[model samples]
Target: MLKPEIKVLDVQGQYRIHTEFYRSDTAENTIILVNGSMATTASFAQTVKNLHPHLNVVLYDQPYAGKSKPHNQHQKMLTKELEAQMLLELIEHFSANYLMSFSWGGTAALTALACTPRRIEKAVISSFSPLINGPMRDYLERGRRCLADCNRTQVGNLVNDTLGKHLPSLFKRFNFKHVSSLAEHEYAQMHFHIEQVLTCDQPCLLDTASGIEIPVLFINGAWDEYTSASDAQHFVQSIENSQFVRLENTGHFLDMEHKSASHISKAAMLGFLQPAHAEHLAASR
Candidate 1:
């Protein structure tokens, strides 16, 4: 039931990133949490509360997403590299040692961690593909069309349908009763990111695998509709010192379960970090 201290960070001396920092006395190491494209720090509320007892957790809104939207006044469009640089600065500022990310944030995390492996000792990345796979490409296309038509009904339907498809068994876990709660500016930002995802062809992580010198743990649902389990395997195989764990009876939202403290996702993360820390301590001895 612990809460994070809110702060506005000036990353890379350019962008102002809004972040939440949670401190824990029983902490093993600091973990930087990167949320999915559509998510804010609130998306990781339960997970953070569960982890705050044992780990120092930091959550942030990426540029043009959530609370950081107003800080993105630069003329240059948001790109993976730009996001990576901002993340690196944030990590340095916060003195965090571990990186944990979901979905699009995974891409940015991978890129940033690859470039600064010495700074980030370990990573737990979930549902992130190095490339835009076929299914994801199709999903982006649908988003592109939805943005082009500028229809609220179409947008709501598209998002709900996509959610239903990805989270058939767990759709009720989310609060989608107020899709209308999304503000106009937020909608435009979503459209812009979708366009970038569709148009940008640059590989975010796989190409820079050689630069990642730290241990990595990749987590994904066995039935993730947006990304295949094979892609998670590909990431593990591509990155050295990387491991993959596929959760059963789940979809893309691994942390979406509306549980209190003992969710599988939270356990898996704590398990990985604890053992990794033990190994680090042993090596130091």
Candidate 2:
């Protein structure tokens, strides 16, 4: 079982943000897992649990997800600045140096890191795209339209529809004790979050990404409906020192359904993160 310990972080206005920490103190490179919108860090439970015992791992819920406190109604997260601030808060709170981000989170996580270069050591993106351009772009637009119209039922229905249509089996995999028990605000927040994702300023970050000299890893599902291998190739070609991995027979959700996103894959990452000696071991084998 994944080692999960509840942790609390104090942020602005004395607000408390809570998350599940998968602790490892004997590690060298510490990894911070960030979930995509409408999801929590619980999604990574199976992946990080079987990682190299020498690497530290942490999975934290964003401000609006899981036990993390939502931002103040007056002080919102519309702009990249607010999102960057939240990223800084989490990094400072945990003193984490590496990031493992998922889908739309790739954009937000990149925004956060680019805004504060001093915070992150390196980053890995699973089923991620720094730019939104195609169907996901259209879907997000539709979602924001629904949010602006205050269509909470539509919002709820859309989430259920997407899961049923694209990931029926995955929906069954998550026996969300709390997510299933969510009330109106939870549902509304989902709508608002979709809207936020579609509208957040991200081009600046994408432009700045070309200059980030960190070891960025892009992991994509071979069958992903959102992003394909070309996207990964383009991302790596554009960003300095970026690497791309295409996992077989998986879709938009990598960390959830892809074997490469599981604990087994974490072992691969462990080997890659090691020094030149381990790289030699991997090559010789």
Candidate 3:
């Protein structure tokens, strides 16, 4: 039910991309789900599987994330704006209609939406604080450190310390194993996995948040030490026609580790993507 539907298309050059369609039979325009840095398309499988079967749900791995092949010269070095640009190429390629982005992917999704301005019906951003600049810059600094000091134990301790501020209950639920895999990533991997961590600009996030005029829905876990609720609030305040949802008892990866939390978040996301899910009734209608 949930797998990467990777297809290689020559839209100018060969592009290998992954897409998960919840209901391939339905002709409805799809809701594109974009992953945060270093995350794969697999993260959204459970969410899309649980969503109303009438809609076309999709999540894809950007160049370096999953099954898609990474091209050193093609990557533009750690920036996925073109990753988003390619998403739009796939959108036109597949004719999708909506989008949802998490963390850094929010920047990419916005580019895809903005380039084809009228195409996206709605977009949802979770655990993201694009319009607010400072925290992300700070986070990126740490990311650079993470790559530089691949001392697993030391880096792990540092990451744990950074996550310490989120309330203990949700913090206990944190997925260290899930993130710990970062330590095992091939050191010789593209960008040394360093290019985007360093070169990718944080203001690109701020500018994207401010630029798009689409109907936006923001999701953040109240205890999310990663992306503060205040920053999410700032974007809601700035972006016209945007709504915010804070899921209780969860940390950063609401869509992954927290089941009920993501279900609750999905209800709001469903409402935001109303026109498609509305066809039924009070039951995801």
The parts of candidate 3 lying over 4 Å away from their true place are 2-6, 10-14, 24-27, 70-76, 131-139, 152-204, 236-238, 275-285
Model 2: residues with Cα > 4 Å off, grouped in runs:
69-80, 145-170, 173-193, 196-205, 258-264, 275-285
After TM-score superposition, the amount by which residue 165's alpha carbon in candidate 3 deviates from its true location, in angstroms, is 9.1
2 or 3, which is superior by TM-score? 2
TM-score of 2: 0.78
Assess each prediction's global lDDT (C-alpha) against the native. 0.72, 0.62, 0.61
For all predicted structures, in order, the TM-scores are 0.84, 0.78, 0.76
Best by TM-score: 1
- lDDT tens digits, residues 101-137, model 3? 8766776776666564567767888787654346545
Q: Is candidate 1 or candidate 2 better by lDDT?
A: 1
State the lDDT of candidate 1 residue by residue for 1-285, as single tens digits. Answer: 666788988887778899989988878678889877667887787668656766799999876667887777745556667888888888887889988988778767887877864568889988766667777787788877765666666666666566435543444335353343555555666677777667766453466665576888888777676765677776655677888787776667766633421266766776787867545544776
Best by lDDT: 1
| Candidates 1 and 3 compared by TM-score, better number | 1
Model 2 local distance difference test score: 0.62
Q: Each candidate: how many clashes?
A: 0, 0, 2
lDDT of 2 by residue, 136-237 (tens): 676677776665666656655654454223444555335333344554454566566666656656554467466667788788766665566666666654
